[model samples]
Target: MTDREKIQQILQGISKTALPAQPSESLFDAGVLDSFSLVDLVAGIEQAFGIKIPDSDLNPRQFDSIEYIEKYLSSHR
Candidate 1:
């Protein structure tokens, strides 16, 4: 599957929230996600995308927005 689809799945699995059709949506800013949710999100992304999300890349910026996460996964893929 494509990165966007994988990301939507990851977000759905982690937050149990309906994912927006657009990829540029701000998951955190929109209150759809929060700091406590990052732990599950990180794990989901790592497993779903088949990419290792190192501790260094686990900062808020990386998870601040869906676009950011998608970009990171795209680079890794």
Candidate 2:
């Protein structure tokens, strides 16, 4: 799958467990994800995409939104 598709899948996985509504543009700001979910997300990205998430890449900006995660992974991958 393309990077965007992978990202959407990742978002879907998260939404399945934690998010009450479909991910909108403001889901991140709406407290849809917390620290525990952030850790789970990083693990999911690493395993799904076969990419190592380095300490340098571990920032809230990268994890805050699905769009940000897609951009970051697309550039790095």
Candidate 3:
């Protein structure tokens, strides 16, 4: 699967709901994710992508949406 697909799958698992239609949509604003879910997302991303995410890079802005998460993963990888 593509990176975006993996992200969406991760998000779906965390949110336990359908993802927003827009890839750029803010998960926080859409009520799909919160501070607690962000932690789960980071763990999922790290495990799925096999990359370690440092605590210094754990900003919400870096993971606010699928597009952003893909970009972050690309850069980190």
Which regions of candidate 2 deviate over 4 angstroms?
17-26
lDDT of 3 at 69: 95
Worst 10 residues of 2 by lDDT: 17-26
Q: Which candidate gets the maximum lDDT versus the true structure?
A: 3
TM-score of each: 0.81, 0.73, 0.95
The TM-score between candidate 3 and the true structure equals 0.95
lDDT of 2 by residue, 17-66 (tens): 44434333444665666677778788889999998999888987677766
Better of 1 and 2 by TM-score: 1
Clashes of each: 0, 0, 0
TM-score of 1: 0.81
- Which candidate number has the best TM-score? 3
lDDT tens digits, residue span 1-77, model 1? 87777777777777766666566777876666877887888888878767788788777877767788878877777
Q: Give the number of colliding residue pairs in candidate 2.
A: 0
Residue 10, model 2: lDDT of 72
Q: Write the per-residue lDDT of candidate 3 for residues 1-77, one digit (tens) a residue.
A: 99999999899888976788999999888888999999999999999999999999999999998989989988877
Clashing pairs in 2: none
